[model samples]
Target: MDPAVLREDMVDGLESDAKGVLHDETVAVAMRDVPRHEFLEDDRTAYADRELEVLGTRVLAPSTVARLLQPLDLEDGHDVLLVGAGVGYTAAVVAEIVGETNVHAVDISRPLVIEARQNLARAGYGGVLVDCRDGANGFPEYAPFDRILLEAAAVDPPRALLEQLTDSGRIVFPCGTQRQRLEAVSADSEREAFAAVSFDPLLVEGEQSGAVERNRMTREDREHATRRAESRRGWEQEWIEWEESVGPQ
Candidate 1:
């Protein structure tokens, strides 16, 4: 409820490190423009002060969402399809990042989608399209997006999702069943090839139960990483360094 703690916890926690800032300008504007607490449940309204609510099946942590967006390199002129709309909190933040006309969100829960649409409307965001549908599969009717982001963790990237990307499009999400991870996927339609970078999934205490333990990349995924690394013979040194920064396998 207190704006002071909200800024300190979510905003400050996210911005404390330079590496944490994804769309800095967008975050700044959203921080000032949107009323995030309004969308949370009655009891957890103030949790926005330092907490995130488990809205339906999706759990939205302010800091986690902010961290997720960091590597996206999103900007204007990009049409983004967001999976897991959540109570529209992530959508609102994204709506602030990418213009409304360029954003659409889909969720599996009907009630959540209704609430998402209304919440965005109440926030005066006209660009985001909230649909009640499966998030694992992107909105195909809109086909071919410049960018795709999944808010939920999956063991692997869904097949249908890749089919919807415009050439050279990029996707960022956490993947892996037991050993969940955050990965960046970039596709080259001409070659039908996609390269991804994955890190240990963010596993926190008191979160969802039944989640599996983190594992090294699958044998295939590992080989892909190795082959991709080898393909860049000249850049091996740098690529290796980058891989190290992502943390050990």
Candidate 2:
């Protein structure tokens, strides 16, 4: 069998599986549309196969990609963020769901970001922000995002990221350690708080979310705020007493 045609056939079969499990037809099209082989370069035969390792350096499961797309329930036009763009293959898929104008991707690897930038273009997903930098802090310039996806495993939830999301946006990632879980964090617009948070036992170690350090400062912040409030109250009382005698305005 020719590898090219075989690849297409395999993808066709994968598409069968996708259609059954995936509820969204648009997601199904994007799954079938983007040539999985282009994103995965080393699998001479993965053009149709479900899994591929890019340049023999990174491994990505086509099923995993498909699964992520399902729960996302992404609308056609949305402002989305991806933390670990890798070679940008997943980002490209996300770009398809969200469209090019509203997709933004970030990563810590320089070469990977460059590769992703090019791959996104090849995938016909232009205007995405694929940048090489620490994904730990999250992208602030594009704040208040609607959807944020963390691609890597984390030891904690990335705080900088949580703060950047629009109130009511969704953040999905794997969290926890020793026993990791896939979790989703959702904000509640009505209450101005997080309404839904689901944590599932992780399949792998959690990705470092940079929340550890911020969490460590929690006690200090509380103590500092308490002291400041007490001081302000004391000053306000003294000023009021003085004004009563001096005739206040």
Report the alpha-carbon TM-score of model 1 versus the true structure: 0.66
> Which sections of candidate 2 miss by over 4 Å?
1-12, 15-23, 42-44, 48-52, 55-57, 189-249
lDDT string for model 2 (21-61, tens) is 44456766676566555665554645533444443234455
List the RMSD of every prediction in angstroms: 14.2, 8.4
All candidates: TM-score: 0.66, 0.66
* lDDT against true structure, model 2: 0.63
Worst 10 residues of 1 by lDDT: 202-211
Q: After superposition, how far is residue 214 of candidate 1 from its true place, in Å?
A: 26
Write one digit per residue (lDDT tens) for candidate 1, span 67-95: 66665667777888888777787777777
Q: Residue 80 deviation, candidate 1, in Å?
A: 0.6
lDDT of each: 0.65, 0.63
Q: Count clashes in each candidate, considering only residues at least 3 apart in sequence or on different chains.
A: 6, 12
**Best candidate, lDDT:** 1
